[model samples]
Target: MASEYVLRIPLDRHVITTQRSLAAVLEDIRRVLHDSAPRSALQGHLVAAGHQVRLIIDRPEATDELVRCLPDAGAYCPATVLVQAAGDGACLAYDSVASAISPYQDEEALAVAELFDAEVLSLLRRVAEPAPGESGQ
Candidate 1:
């Protein structure tokens, strides 16, 4: 089987009540990523399964850093974010950055990918979790 990197987060009602719609969640994710890495690019937005939205992010800056260590590693430039409304509330998923770069097995590439993974994962978690004393809209 082909290798894969995926993160799936189950949503809580408070998050759903705050973010109202998938579009809002997407916007929140986009905003968080933008804040995290302004240089990275948001490449596309897509619809899936009727009620789901996906965001495609191309981090040339991050890839550029990786390429310095392994020039042939340009294929994994863009990453994806998927959000779907479900019976519980909502689910957000994405490919794992480490899994994406692990094929190279290069120490430098793995290190960079690990850092990228941490940053993006943190961003997604922040997007899904509401702040203290703040009601979502």
Candidate 2:
């Protein structure tokens, strides 16, 4: 059985800025995921260096749906994105899809959750990529 985990992707610069806003990146993610900018169940925080967004995706393969089917599914509803200041850069972090599906040992559910993991990681990595013409290390 898989266990809970987190995936953190570092960015070349601060994403939570008016120039390269985290909001914009989040909106982009929503479009890619749902084709609409769904409301975030929770938004913004002072504890983090920059900002954070939390939203529940109630898709057929999401945590909410999984819980409805399998009661043992953990409290994975509402995925999260944290933009934390990293020196002059930033980091985009989130809980792995496996983290939410791990509590349920159902092999079928695990396979579906793995798909979510790949999609989420791809979106985050795309968001963290440096813009065109921008230097990256």
Best by lDDT: 1
CA lDDT scores, all candidates in order: 0.60, 0.51
Cα error of candidate 1 at position 96, Å: 1.2
Kindly report which residue pairs in candidate 1 clash with one another. Answer: 5-96, 18-136, 18-137
Predicted candidate 2 versus true structure: per-residue lDDT over 1-137, tens digit per residue: 88996644332221232233455555555656654333422222223333545444434435555566655554554445565434455456666656556555677666756666566566667756666875432
Give the alpha carbon lDDT tens digit for every residue of 1-137 in model 1: 89977544332111222243455566676565555445564334444556667666556677788788877556554666667765434567766666766666788887876776666666667766655664444
For all predicted structures, in order, the TM-scores are 0.64, 0.56
Clashing pairs in 2: none
Every model's Cα RMSD, please? 7.3, 8.7
Candidate 1's displacement at residue 136, Å, is 7.6
